[model samples]
Target: MTPHHGFTPFFTGDSYISPASKPDWLASALPTLTFYPKAIGVVWRASRQASSGRYDSRHWCESSLNIVRSLETVGCRLRVTGIEQLRKIDRPCIFIGNHMSTLETFVLPSLIMPWVEDLTFVVKRSLTEYPVFGHVMRSRNPVVVDRVNPREDLKTVMNEGGKRLAEGYSLVIFPQHTRTVQFDPTQFNSIGIKLALKNNVPVIPLALLTWAWSPGQLHKDYGPIIPSRTIHFAFGEPLHVSGRGTAEHQQIIDFIQGNLDNWHRQDSD
Candidate 1:
C-alpha cells in the first residue's frame, strides 16, 4: 500500500501461477467462494459511504485501490504494464477496452484513477440502478446505457461522455455490450472510438485478461476466483482518431485480441 507516486502497478512480476506451488491447500479449492463475499463487502461499505454523501473523489479512489489490494492479499496477483504511457498524458482521454468480467469493473479504477485522478466509466444502465451499489456508481456520474437501444446509448455517451471529457475527466468504456471470459471482436462496438474522435481526444487502448475472476453460476459478480490465475492489463500507446475512426477501432480490436491471445497461451503453458 505505498503512495501512488511510487507505485509500480504490478502486484507480482510473474504472471504464471502453478497450483502445485500453492501453499494453502484449503484456500486454493474454494477461492471463488471464499473471496468474492469479502470483495462484495468492500463494495457495500463504499456504496454506503457514497450514498451518505461522505464519499469524495479521494475517498472513492482510495476505496478502489483498497479493494484491489485486499484481493491481492487474498492470493489474486496482478501484473499491469504500460502505466508510464498513462502518466505521460497530461490531459484526459477516453480509455477503451474489452469487457472481460466484473473483475475489471471493480479493479480498474485503482489502476487508472491514481494516474488520471478524475475518471469514470460508461456503464450499463442496470449498474447504476443496482440496489445498494447503484448509489455508489451514480455518484461517479457515469454514462449509463440500456443496451437495448444502441442509438439512444450512443446519444447518451456522446452527449454525456463528451461533456465529461471536456471537463478533463477520463472515461473507461467497455465496448462489448456485456462482459465475457473470451474476447469477441464482433460484439465490440466503436462507440468509444467515435466519442474520442468526435471530442478530439486521444483514445488509450486497454487490454485486460481477467478470467481469473470467474463468473458465478447464480450471481455473476460473486464467482469463483482462481488464485493461481493471474490478472493482466496492458495499455497500448494513445491514438488520435482521424477521419471515420474505422482504423482506430480496428487498432483497438487488434490490441485487445493480440494481448488476450498471448496471455492465454502464457497461462496455458
Candidate 2:
C-alpha cells in the first residue's frame, strides 16, 4: 500500500457488518484455540507495515477491519448502528463510552474510522510501550496517559487531546479506569466530558456490548472467543457542551446505562 500523508475516511456497506447467521459450537471452539496466534500474527504484520511507513490511512483502517473480520470467521456476531449521527458531524467530537472487554479496543476502529478519518484513543501510557502493538498504536498518534495520578492524567488529556482536536482528529475516551464485564456508573468518570467541554466540542455518547471477547486468565487480551455473545455498538447524537459539564456527564452515564440494560435484556430473552 502506498503511504498517504492524510488519513483516509471511506467505508462500504460491508463496513456496517451484521452477520447473516451465528456460528455453531465446533466453529466457535476452533477460533477460541487459534485466536491468540492469529491476533499476534495480524498485529505483527501491521506493525511491520507501520514501521516501514507503508501503513498509511487506508492500510490502518483496512488492517483494523481485517482483525474484526477474522473474529467473524470464528462465528462472532456483531451489530453496529448510529453511523448517520457520526456522518452529520462536521467537526471533531469526543467519543465517550463505558469500557467493556478488550474486544472493543481491537474492534472499534473498524466501526468508527470510516465515519471519522482522523481518529485516535486516549489510552493508558503502558499500551504505547508494548512490543509490536505499541509501534502500531504510536503510529496513529494517540493521546497517552498514566492511570495513576488522576490530576496528571487529566492535564495530559486536556493538553494533548486539545492539540489533536485542533488538528481535526477525533478522540475516543473510556471513562472507566479499567475494563470489566459489568458497567459501574460510579467508576465511569467525567474525564471525556471535561475534555469536550474544555475543547468546545460535542460529546458523542457510545454504548457497546463487546463481551464476545472475554478476559483471559493469563493475558487479558488473549481471552476465550464467545461467538454466541452478539457484539453491539451504538452511537448517540452529539451533545454540545454547556455551562458546567455536570449535566452532560450524567447524560452520558444515563445514555450508556439505558443501552446496556436494553441489550442485556434482549440477550437474556
Candidate 3:
C-alpha cells in the first residue's frame, strides 16, 4: 500500500490504485476498512466520561479499571506489580517512566487514576491536533508542551506541573521525552526528576514493558497475536529530591535502568 498524505492506503497492488481511481476514494474508505469507527468510539466514550466534571477522582478510577479490563479482553494483558508501593504514599508524586509505545498512554491512566484524585500527563503539542483524541486530551486538561522552544516549554512544565501538584494531582511523565524502538540508558533524561525537585514532590519510577504488543498494524492478515507476550507495569520506591543536583538526577536514571534490566532478565529466565 502506498502512503498518501499522512495515511497509508488500505490495499496494495496496481489494481487497487489505477489512473481512473482517485486518491480521495481510498482515503475515505480506509478509516472504515481499518476499524477506525470502533477505535474512535472507544476513545470518544472514555474521554467524554473522563472529562465530565460530574465525576470525582474515585469515579474516574473505577472507569479506568473497567477500561483496562476491556482492553485485556482483546488480547492486551497488563501484569502489574509493585502497586502496593503506590498504596503507601500519602501525598502527590511525579511518576517517571520510560517511553516505548502508545500502550502506556492508555494503560497508565487506568492504573493510577484510582489512587490519585487528579492525574495529568505532559504531552507533545502536536498530539493536540488529533481529531477525537485531541478533544479528549484538551478536556482532560493535560499540560501540553512545545518541544521546539526548550526555554518556554520548560517554563510551562514547571509552572503548570507545580500548580497541578499543589492541587493534589499526580503527574505522569515520560522522562525520555519521546518514544523509541528500544530503551537505552543514554537516551533517558532527568527532566522528570527536575520537575519533582522544583515542585517538591516525590518521584515515583515506573518501568513499563509494553513494546511487545504491536497495535494497529497496516494489515489485519499480519498474523495472530503473540501469546505469552507479557506487559509489565512496575512502580519503584519513591525518590525524594535532596541537595544533590546532577547526582540525584543520575541516581534516578540508574534506578529506572536497573529495574528495567532486572524485569527483562527475569522474563528471559
Candidate 4:
C-alpha cells in the first residue's frame, strides 16, 4: 500500500540518530508490551501485500519505517551514519556485512531503498521459509542458499547473484555463516567479495548492532525487545573489488569489528 507517514523525509539526512526524547511519553513509562506487537503488525500487513503481489520496495520501506517507529516509541534509540555512501555509486553493488540479529533484516530497507530503488538480499533458504516474514523475503527475489555447503552456496550466489546485479538490483549479503549476537571475525566469509569481484561491482561494507532485539532463546528470529539497548547501522565507503578479494574481504571484517567495539564501549560508558 502506501508508505508510512513521512517515510520519504524521515531519513533524508546523511546520518540519523533517533531523538533523545521518546515520541510517545505515555508509551515511555509503560513496559515493552506493545513494542514487538506494533512492529510485527506492520510486518504482517506487508507480508499479506507481498503474498498478493502488491508489495515492492516502497512497501518494504514503509514496513521498515514503522518498525523503527515502533522501536523508538518504546525508547530504543537508533543511530545511523554514512547514509551518503549509498549515493556514492551510480550502479548496483554488493553490500556485505556481519549478521547479528533479525533487526537488520527489518530495518535496513528503510535506509537503503531511498537511494537504491532496486535491492534484494542474499539470505539463507530458511529465511525464505519464515512464516509471514518469509513471504516478503521471497517476493524480493533474493539469492537464497541452504547455508549447509559452502561450495554449493557460493555457486548459487555467483550464478543467481550475477543475474540480479546485472538487472540493477543491489544485493545485501551477510557473509556470517551462522547469525550470532556476538561479532566473530573468524566466522565471516568472503562470498560477497567473490560475488562482487566476479560481477565487476563495488562492495560496500555495512556495520550494524541490533542487540536491542535480543536473539531469542527459543525462536531465533522472534526475540525479546530490550528498549535500553541502542541500535546502530554504519555504512562504509565502497571498495572496488580486485584480484582475489582477500584484502577487500578483510577490510569489510575490520570495518564491522571496529564499529562493534566502539558501540560496545559507548554503551558501557
Model 1 lDDT tens row, 163-235: 9998878999999878888788999999998898888989999999988788879988667777678889988
- Model 2 CA lDDT for position 31: 70
Query: Where is model 4 more than 4 Å wrong at Cα?
Result: 1-9, 23-31
Would you estimate the TM-scores of all the predictions? 0.89, 0.91, 0.74, 0.93
Ten residues in a row with the worst lDDT in model 4? 1-10
Candidate 2 lDDT, 1-269, residue by residue in tens: 21123554433333365557655675655878756676788889989997887776566677777778778877877777776677766778899999888778777776676666478999998888988988888888999999999999999999999999999888999988899888999999998888888889999999999988888899886778887798888888899989888988898899899999998998899
Please estimate how well model 3 matches the true structure, expressed as its whole-model Cα lDDT.
0.63
What's the distance in Å from true for residue 90, model 3?
A: 1.6
Record all residue pairs in model 3 with backbone atoms less than 3 Å apart, i.e. clashing: none
Candidate 3 lDDT tens digits, 1-269: 11212322222222111122222443334422333333445667756764564444444444455544444444444566666566656678888888766657766765666555568888888667776566666755678898777778778888998888898888988867567646777777677777888778888878777754354467321222332455677777777887745766676677667767877787789
**Residue pairs in candidate 4 whose N, alpha carbon or C atoms collide under 3 angstroms:** none
RMSD of 1: 3.5
RMSD of candidate 2 to the truth, in angstroms, is: 3.4
- Tens-digit per-residue lDDT, 1-269, candidate 4: 12232346467668998988755665666535668778779978988999999998778887889999888888889999988887776788889998888889989988887776488999888889988989999999999999888899989999999999999899999988777879888888898998899899999999999988887778887677788888999999999989998999889999999999999999999
Q: lDDT score, residue 34, model 3?
A: 31
Please give the lDDT score for candidate 2: 0.81
